[model samples]
Target: MDETWAPEACTLPTAERPFRVAEFDDLFATHLRRSERVDPQTLDLTLNPESRATVEDLTARETECCSFFTFTLTGTTELHLRITVPPTQTAVLDGLLA
Candidate 1:
């Protein structure tokens, strides 16, 4: 993901941003089964059941530093991650899958 689109609201720190991006990269490579843009403000990631814990942990940490984002996980036998951002943060959300 290109972190260039990240806005001023991100407080993850310049040094740690790449690491965060790497974590997302790993998650997408390892467990992500499907990806969809639900709307201009939202993205949906369907991951394997095995990714529940990792997804939860990552999203939690992400929300801690980037409060502009809203991450939701829902599914019974599957892991569904819904990432949402306010309309003003659409560019940041777009960078998520880039």
Candidate 2:
């Protein structure tokens, strides 16, 4: 993951709130698979109150591996995200390139 791509601030209407977006890297993948479930608490580490709420809500929807998880924040300033946990090592590498 490129450190430069790390989210620095909220781009939503709740810009006053803090938020971050990070690509799932090797370390994170190892932990995620080992756990067999994505830990919301750990994921929350990169989010603000509003963004956390949004994530909590979105994660409830059923999804499949390698599918992109998209987040759209409404209100004054809109924020978008394309999150994905690739299915295989090759897929992960491909996703990173994309």
Candidate 3:
């Protein structure tokens, strides 16, 4: 993915980057259950129990770089992370999701 909007140049400061990387790695490695495309530019992701805090923190920081994305988390028993992007950014998101 090109990630032109959220280029590596916009990554968090060095000290924070590692922690974010570790946090996302943990989320992907153990918390994420699955991901799906709910619409042309929307992604519906399922996460395991207890991932709310991590997902919130991650998405909060993500918007700093990629404001085009909108993250909405919902559900009680099962959590869902809804990531919505504009039509102009769908291809970039598709590459990321791929």
Candidate 4:
């Protein structure tokens, strides 16, 4: 991984209340639908369903190196996601705005 692409430190807010894994999925799906810049293929989620807890939330903040995306699943909220745009698709994303 390139040093420039390293993820930055960030914190996400805890969910208002406890929710099941399925509830988290529904929230994630709704977020995806509302965001035009986000693609389904680029958003890959690996959640542990066995460990259930209350409070599910997410927060994003910018850093000096790269933008940080974090998810708060259950009580623990330290999930860091690193997203990479392939050379081929890089052009596609750029062209969309241009």
Name the lDDT value of residue 16 in candidate 1: 87
Candidate 1: tens digits of C-alpha lDDT, residues 26-96: 99999989999989999999999988888889999999889989998999688889999999999988888
lDDT of 4 at 87: 41
TM match of model 2 to true structure: 0.23
Per-prediction TM-score to the true structure, in the order listed: 0.94, 0.23, 0.71, 0.19
Mind giving the per-residue lDDT tens digits that candidate 3 earns over 12-60?
5655655655666668688878988888889888898698887888899
Clashing pairs counted in every model: 0, 0, 0, 1
| Ordering by TM-score | 1, 3, 2, 4
For model 4, residues 2-44, the per-residue Cα lDDT tens digits are: 1222212312222312232234445444432222335622433
For model 1, the stretches where C-alpha displacement exceeds 4 angstroms are none
lDDT of 2 by residue, 4-24 (tens): 321223132233112221323
lDDT on C-alpha atoms for all candidate structures:
0.90, 0.30, 0.73, 0.31
Ranking by lDDT: 1, 3, 4, 2
**Which candidate achieves the best TM-score against the true structure?**
1
> Candidate 2: global Cα-lDDT?
0.30
The collision pairs in model 4 are 18-54
lDDT-better candidate, 1 vs 3: 1
